[model samples]
Target: MAAFFKAVNAKIRSNPALSYLCSTHFWGPASNFGIPIAAVMDAQKSPELISGQMTFALTIYSATFMRYALAVTPKNYLLFLCHFINEGSQLTQGYRYLQWHHWGGREKAGVHGAVEEAKEKAAAVGDKIKEVASK
Candidate 1:
């Protein structure tokens, strides 16, 4: 098995393109790219389906891995690029989550909307008290 790998390695190293294709540097990032691709595809779906906690977690995960990719020996730019794209997608997902759950998106009044509604009622009551006092 060792001899087989040794022969294959030797043959691969002779061609720059094949050498790159065989290296961990190439394949590691290549595999990691699927994550960002999936996130991007998922973004097209409704924000109602997005979990705020999961989106926040993935955003942080991508940020941490992006730094790790750059800090590692040989500086895996492909991996960095993968995580960078993932980070963007995750951030966008986070925004969507906030919009849906807090900012009253999709015609559904959410937390922010509820708070605003409560504040308006309170102000109206306060105005009535001042009007009665003035009279």
Candidate 2:
């Protein structure tokens, strides 16, 4: 399926006519995949989206595509979160916390004020995001 999407995206990118079509309001192929991805992980079944393997699969796939990240990777954080109330996951808190490693982005460090700091022995960069977010 990823291969198919990649092919479709590539094809659209290659053709000027298709590019125009993709740029339209709601006729693009992205919506085509969005609806199904949502359905595969039916929201009504589990608050944590545990039944839908597609979300998990996409999380793992997206995370694996990124560089070394913390346990609470952006992919997992967004995907694992519940649409309504809080959700659940097979992933442990520790594992989820570790995905915050974040080796890629422009940031100098990962999670701040979290227990992962003690695990990594990082004391100085603890509040890296605080100043920025507070502003």
Candidate 3:
């Protein structure tokens, strides 16, 4: 078993795409065990806790893809970028979700407020674009 994994690790390290797929090992545990557990323990009274449901869903997503992605052959390296982007976006969204839902530090409030304002402005810009497109 150790030999098998050793060979597998070598293969993974040799290919950029496989190296990216292997990163799911870190993300899987963060999504599954870290965020939801921390939220329950530390943010129990806070209304802005990261959704445990979403965290668990992403955990399952990462776990499922990690198995499938690692089996990808070198011939299909071109398609691997699509898979990497998909997983990268999932993890990025998870990070943003945690920041938006869980962070409440006093020092970061100014930056957080700016972010909220930016979101509102972006929505208005989107509405304007839609209105122009309709006309």
What is candidate 1's lDDT per residue for 72-115, written digit by digit as tens? 89798888999999999999989988888677785564545677
Ranking by TM-score: 1, 3, 2
Across 43-134, the per-residue lDDT of candidate 2 in tens digits comes to 33423323335445645544442222234323322232221111223232213333333332213333243456575655445565666678
Candidate 2 Cα errors over 4 Å, as ranges? 1-18, 22-32, 35-41, 47-49, 52-54, 63-135
The TM-score between candidate 2 and the true structure equals 0.21
> In terms of lDDT, which candidate is strongest?
1
Better of 1 and 3 by TM-score: 1
Tell me the spans in candidate 1 whose CA falls farther than 4 Å from its real position: 1-5, 106-135
TM-score of each: 0.72, 0.21, 0.32
Score candidate 1 by TM-score against the native: 0.72
- Predict model 3's lDDT versus the native: 0.57
lDDT of 3 by residue, 31-119 (tens): 44443344435433433445656655755665555556566553333233334444554555556466665654423556567878899
Query: What does the lDDT read for residue 88 in candidate 1?
Result: 96
Candidate lDDT values, in order: 0.89, 0.41, 0.57
Q: Candidate 2 overall Cα lDDT vs. reference?
A: 0.41
- Going through the candidates in the order shown, the clash numbers are 0, 14, 0
What are the C-alpha RMSDs, in order, of all predicted structures?
11.0, 19.3, 15.3
lDDT of model 2, residue 39? 43
